[model samples]
Target: MSIPAAFDYHPAQTVDEALSLLQQYGDDAKILAGGHSLIPAMKLRLAQPEHLVDIGRIQGLSYIKEEQDTIAIGALTTYTQIERSDLLQQYFPLMVECASIIADQQVRNRGTIGGSIAHADPAGDMPGVILALKGEIVVQGPGGKRTIAADDFILGAFETALEPDEIVIELRFARPPAHTGSAYQKLANQASHYAIVGSAVVLTLDANKTCTAASVVITGASMKTERSRAVEQALIGKQLDTATITDAASHAADELELVSDIHGSEEYRKQMASVIVRRTINSALERIS
Candidate 1:
């Protein structure tokens, strides 16, 4: 399983270095953050970039910090680091849930947050999770820096709004307001280690024990991980009860074009989306209660 031959492997000590390489080589240049996705694609001859600009060596860019409003996570942060971060555990346990479900320990140790988002796989846990949390991506290019909302950034399967010269630097999101809680649940495929169905729910409750707002973003069950808008609209101002939960869950696949691989059928994934939506929402609601 050797990767295809490339002309150069440049370990960049900074984002400017990587951007310069990209500018020089244009389409033949590829930014390598963690190599979890690109390496596999290269092995299959699916990607043929002539130059790889490694960004993993950059320092001072792998931290989880809580600002006055939002929490900031560096792009180079590892899944294991996220899973073990005490600040994340207290402020955003849903991320820890995503970390635990991504893969086994070895993959988590090496797979980076930036690489996962850049790969933009429809079945990725964090992309769908960050969507639910309304995360924002901070990217830098030759011109300067720009921030894109999570919902707007992920365009489709293996696609994002990023330009060729852009490099993701960090992710940011406001901490879920008090009384808000979240959870992530996934059903993974055996061989590919991709999710057949993954759902992350972030529930914001009011003082009266009612759902003030919610987001249910599911992946692997569709062409791309998408927000269950019908479900979210159904939960607003509703009491977090079993009967209401059931009703909301019924709308899980209201307008989805699910993907069917050897792992499962369209009908099966749709059915499971409803189930995971119910379970994940309930689990998150429990935390808030």
Candidate 2:
């Protein structure tokens, strides 16, 4: 890969300072968190920002804590941190599972959740998990801070709703209801460990083993992470059994704008989506209390 184009670096210790720098530089600046994604893109000349506002030094932006009814995660929290977090293990084990399988140890230690989501790679594992869990992304800009639902935050490949002057600060996930369980399943590329196709599911069950609510999201098969509304609609209010799950999972790729590439053809990805979705939902059901 070619060396990254020359760029100026500014280290910001506070969120306000970061926002100010972003405003000053506008679209010419890129926020650097762990640099796992940004640096690679820069080296490949896919991105050539003139200024990099390094926010790794920013405090209060790398924590995992419960706030009121939500589990709040700082944007700069690395994948390794999520993989090892006791709190996340207890409350959102699917996130832990997802984190554990991302890339490899070295990448996980340096890849921030915010950077991954903001990069919005089609094969990224985080976006589907967050969408399934109904998380919110909190961002700060020149005006003020605001929260965007995960469903609306990620727009497409390498795209998000963030303004040029905004930086992601936090991610918030509401505590799941009792008897809720979640799972993530991926068909990983052997070389890079990026998902060829992945699915995430969250299911809330009643005492009778009926699914009260369901969220099914798939990534890597498409240009962006997307909820499988047809699959969800087929599960809610129904008793989850092998037959039901099989039927619902058949819709995993419904309406999805699947991408065809060297990793897999569109048809191959569509077929695998159903298989992974089934496995993910079954795994989630087994975890329900």
Candidate 3:
């Protein structure tokens, strides 16, 4: 049986209490939210933090609200909540669509978006989608709160820009412009359900079906989720056609130093990157048309 190492558990009732515990424990402490990822690592001895500060009971941190031109989701919000939210479905269907396919129903009920993003696993699907949609991560610490763009939040595998004493508070996303559509496509490993190669695309088209803006992001094939500048450049000002998407998606791996693991070879992942990007782009275009 897999079992975790010895550790002191601190269940914080408020965000301030969580922050104070983190400050006291310093680097030896780990924040526990959903614990879907961290607990497994602990059992494997891959993570052996001396202290665990759990903030799952912090009230008012699991809401979804629309404010003017943006939607704000509390960090502790579960994947199940996002999947079931009528507001999220109406405004950002991409998020709801992606949430529906994450793991199984049980994991969805327990896994929080904040925990998933903070874990920063290379195979995570949300990071790529967030990058494509230009989401922001809001965090709070001893100095107060600040926001960082999705592109700058995840540094690498199992890493983030969050300071040791900081905790994620919420996620903010600007409402997409009119005539905009987005989609996420992924090839997943059968056992773990983690992405083998995933792509997310967001595009804004003018009346003539010419792309006014485009953002492409890919994951599971690199050290971190990365925006595809080459793909975006190829799509901007161009119509979404077979030839245009093919040309753009062909550059999916151009700027990435891809990951090679037992599940896939580097060359195989490179090929799938383009394939997923093309499919994702096609899906987004269909939604608007």
Q: Candidate 3: which pairs clash? A: none
Query: Residue 234: error of model 2 in Å?
Result: 0.8
TM-score between model 3 and native: 0.98
Q: Where does candidate 3 stray beyond 4 Å? A: none
| Residue 180, model 2: Cα distance from true site in angstroms | 0.9
- Candidate 1 lDDT over residue span 239-269, tens digit each: 9789999999988988788888788899998
Against the hidden reference, what TM-scores do the models get?
A: 0.97, 0.98, 0.98
lDDT of 3 at 151: 89
Q: For residues 77-183, write the lDDT of model 2, one tens digit per residue.
A: 99999999999998999999999999989999989988888888889999889899999999988888999999999898888999888889999999999999999
Q: Kindly list the per-residue Cα lDDT of model 3 for residues 1-289, writing each as its tens digit.
A: 3788899999999999999999999999999999989999999988999999998989999999999999999999999999999998887888898888888898899899888888888888777777788999999999999999998998988888999999999999999888988898899999988899998889999999999999999989998888999999999999889999999999999998899999999999999999999999999998884
Assess the local accuracy of residue 76 in candidate 2 as a C-alpha lDDT between 0 and 100: 93
Which is the leading candidate under lDDT?
Answer: 2
Residue 276 in candidate 1, Cα distance off native in Å: 0.8
Task: Give the lDDT of residue 83 in candidate 2.
Answer: 95
Per-candidate alpha-carbon RMSD to the true structure: 1.2, 0.9, 0.9
